[model samples]
Target chain A: MFKLLISLALLLWVNTSFAISLIVNDSVSFSPDSSKDIRNIFTLQQTHWENGNKIQVFVFPDDNDVHQQFSKSVTQMFPYQYRRIWDRVTFSGTGLAPTIVNSMEEMLEKVSQTKNSIGYIENIDKHQSIRVIILQGDENEAQ
Target chain B: MKHNKRYFHASLLQKGLLSLLLALWIQPAFAIELADNIQVHGFLTQGAFYTSDNNYNGDSDDDVSFDQTEIGLNAFWQVNDRVDFSVQGLYRKAGKVENGDVRLDYGMMNVNLFNDENNHFGLRLGRIKNPIGLYNETRDVAFTTPSILLPQSIYLERSRSLLVASDGGQLFSKHQLGDGWLSIKLNYGNTHNDNDEIRDQMFVSYAHGDLDSEDGSFVGQIKYNYQSDKYIFALSYADVTLEYDSSSRDLIPFADGTARFSPYIFSAQYNGEKLSLTTEYYYSENEFKDFGAYSPDLSPITTNWYVQGEYRLSHKWQAIMRYDESYLDKDDRSGKNYEAMGAPGHMGFTKDSMIGVRWDIRPDVMLRAEYHNINGTSWLPNADNPDRKETKRYWDLFSLQMSYRF
Candidate 1:
């Protein structure tokens, strides 16, 4: 009984480690829209923001664990589906692919420094460089 | 002899493409990092095929052939919020038909006239890939296609150059439609006017000449994606007319004529977590008129379709099965009437069943193998097998390919 309890606690701890949060530059000045809208932006269907600023998207590579987690939990999609969508648009010359960063540190740095930039990281660290863009359902609770 | 001259001319275009490709391939190596918004990507693939009977992608009868390969490089730059530029160059060798030709696949400048939270309106001008079915735009990319060779029923490999891309302008809009997203595109341009393979295969013994695409060639497609991008449905249409300029030594001496080809396609797909199902149907009304000799006025409505299912067994392994068919005349499924029209019975239609596996060895590298059991020789490329009598009614083919993209 004691072993089962400890194993369950360890599993929860591992699950928490896989959590991801959406982040954007401080200049974005926009709240996360509906899930559909967020998906469109990431899929390159929506090229610009409401304020006429070109949306610059950054992301970790497809094989990254954090990237997969963010795609499922936040975008509500699998990595292959997301990659297929990007490949269709990119290879067809209909749209551009998002910039790929090598590491989470690079993703954080690029998203924070670039204007109108958006990305996700494994954790939401308190820093002046980045601001967490809470999702639609979590916005009120976060505030 | 006329076909030889045309091939020579086409090879010249290929040469120019090759030089430009080289420039692009080496430019980035020496150039400084332009900006964070500038991105360059490319892919390379080499394929080998073997056939029990008949020939495809080269003379693959009872022997393996490595006459299929593709190389492409593209770059994109976001100049600003409303404007972006993109260009891709391709070098492909598909047996005697394509022959290592380098071509400009697409070079377009997109201007986002209006963009908001839910609406996007854009205009693009240059050589653009025609949005026929789901796979037409990125058909050459091995990673993007379900198989190394796409379904020939709808995506005909012969006469591919004419249908792939055009030089013109396009206007597009993407907006929210109820619970799904709707995308509409309209384009008008001059077709890529390569008539060698078309004349060789489509005309056969009936006629021979150079085909020149006249004005007023256009294409359009409308697509809707359901919530979360699970289900997608699209309809596309294209109308292209080519003028036949006859040579003196033609099989049937005749005056100049016009060949008008128009095809309508319906496409749908359901994408799930580990399983994906897709299908597309095509109907084409093609007419040839005014060739004053023994050539009779011919108007044939060809129909074709394919059903494919893919299951991802693991992160690195995937399995696929598909059934594809194409009929030269829907009314004559057995081709008895077509055969009576001086064409071989096997030319009337083709049915193919295929199974394949793909293993992604790495994020950028992939290896794949597939087997095909084909009935009828309707889609046999004329360039590879110039003599029709040599083609068999039933054949089997196995293919292996490796591709890498960065």
Candidate 2:
């Protein structure tokens, strides 16, 4: 019983995390209205931007803290679900998986340099070149 | 000439896949980065199986079997905005069927005709995996599935090679529905019919001949995802035709005959944060006709289904439970007709209850183990069990697999 209680407490603690920003390349013109579009972009269902630039998806690894925050709080999905989608699409040769970066620094760098790319980070600095996409849903605000 | 040409191509594919497997050994998964906009990925899986009272994937009855192994290397190149090309080579071993053979899994050139955030259209030409169920295309890759063994009632190993992939073209389209997306795919091509397991399935013990399906086959699916990860639904359909030719020297050889299969699948799933529920139903119509003096004309309507639940213990561990069932003739649930026709009654159906656990030891590695308590022997592959009468009605199977992917 004590072990079960500890596991439950840990689950709740992990479920609660700090917010993360949905960083995108500044060249994208249209903004996503709801969390569905954001989820579609990460899952590779939405491939191209309004301006015709192909969507280059980037992400942290499944075990990353920022990734856990972005997945649970923002997209309302688990990280393993994203991994499942990516692996299924990749191995079947139907689509592409997201590029994995090491840390927030790498995430900021990749999203800033790549064209029409999208990723997330815990915090953005003042001079970073990437644009922050604010979701309109009732979830959580940007960190 | 055509037969020889096909043999030549198979050998070429074997050599290519083998050399690539050797080349990728030195450079591990994480260190090797090919180029920008061009990526290469690969995976390897090894499994050992132990079964009581029946043979599976080897002589596994009361013995440990190591016949299940798969290695694959795939490369993808995105050429500009509208087109991309991808190819994969595979080396797989599963008992005497698919015995350490190399195969060209899929090589496709995809062209995007039109695309936006809400709508997209595309075409893929070359060898491509058939979009049968949600898991058929990525079935061999252990990282993509729920357990070491997929539900046998729906994804039967006995006739797997026939439905693995096709050499032809496919058209795919996606459209935004109410807060979700609906995708449609249509494929028309020729599937391989050279597998001995399939031949064993189509004929009786002493009826030695060959099975061919040079004619074309058709497969299509319509799938809908609601809220991206909340609810999913799909419907898949396929029609295949196989022909048999008798060899002169064979004893008890029958004349040329034809067999046809038309199957429909209904699939649904619910994905929550900690738990996932999946269920699928399969209904098929089989027809066998025009074999002089073999048996009688037969048509069996088959049904199969499975329901499963998975729970995540943490990010790195998960558990699964499933109940699967299959019937060759729904009217004869006890297989009484088969028993009347000189085969075991249990040969016409199978019911399996399974439990499994998975551990993700690292980001690129996974290990899974499963145990199944099964009743009946309808889905056992013939290559592993040459005589149907030797199989026991009640059996058990345990398997463990380790996989590496990047």
Candidate 3:
């Protein structure tokens, strides 16, 4: 009985550590106006503010662990596949790939300042400037 | 024409300054977080090729020797989560055309129809690459097969009937099937031009692949093509009839021979981290009918296949070797033949065995030097005069090509 309790505790700890949360600035709103259902605040396609406006996007840089998790949860596509798809899109004159931002603070600041932007950041503290868009998994369970 | 020239000059100057400024700006920005929402990137490739037999024939004396150069540029821009666009341009010079001629290889808009958590679908329409073979699909500068030289059997030089662009649409869908994944692509469109004397020829091909991992994969494709990739493969069973004016009627031995033809191909490819191989077999048969009694029946069968291997010596250099052979059966004369001495010649065989080295000057550019020993029997008729034949025994051919992508 004691061994079972210890093992259950360890599994819970592992699951929590691996669990990822996506966050966005509160200013952005869910839009039926755009082709998709949701949008985030970002700038320059990265998480930077361009003239005090935030941009929006789908993925992050190569080294960010949170970015990797977010990508897996949201698109189920790896960084390589995402990049290839973006490359094809860009070369075909379709649209641009999303920009990358560093740190949650930068993502928050950029998103708060930008309009019609979208992005994903780690959820920790709730803020007035951003809102957490609930994501559902393949099982339709909210992540 | 004058206004177009002026616009071209002005754009050239503007692009030069913009590129310089972009390079400077991007260098400092690299340290920070990448911008979000939208990103702009592109690549350019320029290359030169020198061939021993410029005429593409075994006869060296007819020597139409020249240097060939080509430049390709590709750009991509994403609008939002579900929409994107890309444009590619190519400039090529083969013989003494003086100024290089430019053509748009791919300019298309892609719309993501379904972008769910696990699945995505996209549709593209414009001047797109004809995805007939494994290598032909990725003919763009950024994506290339392992070898420096694509298999000539499919991507033949000067064969616009094959490897050319198509004004069409393609639909692609991907779904995660349990542990592995599957992708399906369907393409439908018309040929760019009626170069083969056949008008409004339609092409349809299907490709499917399963991803085992990042480093290895298998893909298969089937296509019905009317154009010749390199040297004509005679295994096609489609009907090809030539449209003849009264003046040219005497030149043709058969008055009722149709000029329509069709070809069927089955191809497969496997790619590993260090090694890749692709092999294909094609069959085409031309039938001539409604000709006079003197018309002879000619049936030809052609078989073509090539195997290539590559070893990455380092990040910047690689070595490759390829062996290619094609055989045609000329003795089968079920179709109409237009000669008094029965069929003009027996079905012949051609072989090109080559070994080459490629230097990756950069990710978007490469330089290759190759040597090929070519041996062949029989000859194909020239476009101008069908009665004349050009055949050769064996020759040593040396070639050098530089390819780049911007």
Estimate candidate 1's alpha-carbon lDDT, on a 0 to 1 scale: 0.78
lDDT of 1 at B150: 96
**Candidate 2 chain B lDDT trough over 10 residues, lowest sum:** B1-10
Each model's fraction of native contacts:
0.66, 0.60, 0.28
Reference-based lDDT, each prediction: 0.78, 0.78, 0.42
Q: For candidate 3, lDDT tens digit of each residue in B293-396?
A: 54444445545567766665764677878887665444523212212333323214556788888786644445677777766522221221122233234645
TM-score of B-chain for each predicted structure, in order: 0.90, 0.91, 0.65
lDDT of 2: 0.78
In lDDT terms, how accurate is model 3?
0.42
Model 2, A55: alpha-carbon shift in Å? 0.9
Name the docking class for model 1: acceptable
Cα deviation of B156 in candidate 3 (Å)? 3.2
Off by over 4 Å in 2: A1-17, A125-143, B1-32
Ranking by DockQ: 2, 1, 3
- Give per-residue CA lDDT, model 2, range B261-363, as digits (tens): 8999999999998899999999999988887776567898999999999999998899999999999888888888667656678988999999999998777
Q: What is candidate 1's DockQ?
A: 0.40
| Tens digits of per-residue lDDT for model 1, B128-234 | 89999989999999989999889999888876888898899999999977767899989999988777777766567455678889795899999998864689999
* Candidate 3 C-alpha error for residue B284, in Å: 4.1
Question: For model 1, which pairs clash?
Answer: none
TM-score of each: 0.88, 0.88, 0.56
